[model samples]
Target: MPAAGRLLAERHKDHRKRHPLLPAEYEDEQLAVVEVTALWESESASGAVLLEDSELTGYVLGAPKPSPVWGPNLWVEAAGQAVREPEHIRDLYAAAAAKWVDDGRTVQYVVVPDDADLLDAWFRSGFGAQHAHAVRPAPTTRLEPPAGLKVRRALRDDIAVLAELDLVLPKYQSRSPVFSAGELPTLEEALADWEESIDDQDYATFVAEYDGRVIGMSVGCSVEKSSAHSGLARPDNAGFLGYAAVLPEARGHGAGRALGEAVMQWSADTGYTAVVADWRVTNLLASRTWPRLGFQQTFHRLHRAIGY
Candidate 1:
């Protein structure tokens, strides 16, 4: 990529007004523009495209490499007036898919149904929104590390133990809501990736050891771009407080609080103006901890099921 010619701040502002789902911040400015006008860059890219040459009625965003994202790992996002020419659309999509297949990413994320031009075009285009995920903002406001638990920076030796601990403690809780549940089939794969994440420069992994036992753990991954209300730009180790988990026995011992506060202090000491974390509206811990840490729900994105 030579250079992303345009400034994202301009596009970001416009997208915010039009599509609230678009993240308010851009971690990589060049990446944002490259992603935005992927339709125009299709010739240079290996990915297929869904385009409209006449009337310039439609637009698509595609990438040679698929980003790690939740919504079908999307690289193409497009919506526009009808692309009525019809003949070119299929080739466009096929080209894009071929590009993605051959590209290293080995995945293609596209917006579904191609509602603007043709439904079958979308079906033929080979794109589906099988399961949708939302990228809501995580809390960036710092909360002090709680007392009573010893907090310290993580080490490589700690990863194996952390990996096993992470597998269960804060495991997906949907099934019980009151108890921990099964790991998704792909969870181990995600865990494999976290091996690299344990050493990522953007984050800090801190553990709270109670009586020499690592009862609780908290991980903070920094965000280059953030949507916190503070509107500060480019804070280092601007921690994204995640992987906050506590053992069952340590549940009420203020372990979570201690781990959380430690991360906050580190964020403060490291000179970040804020940190970010999130919880489902239904999660009880979020209901308590967020408020206790002076966090407030800035916005709500409601989920709805359709075509059932």
Candidate 2:
């Protein structure tokens, strides 16, 4: 389509509009057009381009294996451009989803948070917000623990306690309408995850203690710049934060804050320049807490499930 470049340009422009603080790279639409067009050269990629009087009005490209988080389904790997024009977006998705559904795919995921019109189109086509990724510079704050508590790297024996903290996230999300409800992981699953983290040299796990009782936990690890989308994090020397939580009874006691500081401390000590993390938007506590700790929203993962 002659208008493909322009449509993709609109996508980049819309993204930068949604995130005003985004780095200057996002302002370069030509680069975005190059990246998006390259996906279409893949053999498995498929999509539709709508035209009104021979001008591209909308387009979508779907591909398998774009990510593991969305399960075994076709991801809307790249899509945008004139989507908000009446039924254009819904029609494009309808055409794309029909083929995937017939081929036995059951889910579709797309990342498009910065465009209100595009998001509205997605909502009209059955998509809902699922995840939010946030980032910030490695903090230098002098976070000291409360008088009765201390924070330090968690030992292997502390695996069980860290697993308990991991459960809080699922429990919190289960009650929030905006997040998918699901069964809590078994203790075995939680332990296995923590064990993998502990064994990885690049990862660090921390816990907060009060009178020798563990009250909170956090995990930090190196992140691959190439694996993350452009502009989501700095292009180099980045880190990723995993689960972090403090027990309900320990809310105001500084255990959570201390644990967070420990993660940032680990990032700095390990030579990382910035860190990334994600939390559900509907979880009221996290919605308030993460921003307060300086994590700025970078991208939103939108989900749509048309039952098989």
Question: Top model by TM-score, which number?
Answer: 2
My TM-score estimates for the predictions, one after another, are: 0.49, 0.75
Each model's lDDT: 0.49, 0.69
Query: For model 2, how does the per-residue alpha-carbon lDDT over 1-308 read when each residue is reduced to its tens digit?
Result: 33565666665566556544444453355655665676677657777878778767777777776455556677664333335374577898888777788876667777664556667778888877866777777766655666888898889999888888888778767774645555678878988998876767766888899888998888877766234445322324667776688887777777776777778778877887777767777777767777787877766667766773
Residue 9 lDDT, candidate 1, scale 0-100: 38
Question: Which 10 consecutive residues of model 1 have the lowest summed lDDT?
Answer: 298-307
lDDT of 1 by residue, 152-233 (tens): 8877767655665675444545444534233343456646866777788777788877777777678765654334312212
User: Residue-pair clashes per candidate, as listed?
Assistant: 14, 0
Give candidate 1's root-mean-square deviation (CA, Å): 9.5
Q: List the residue pairs that clash in candidate 2.
A: none
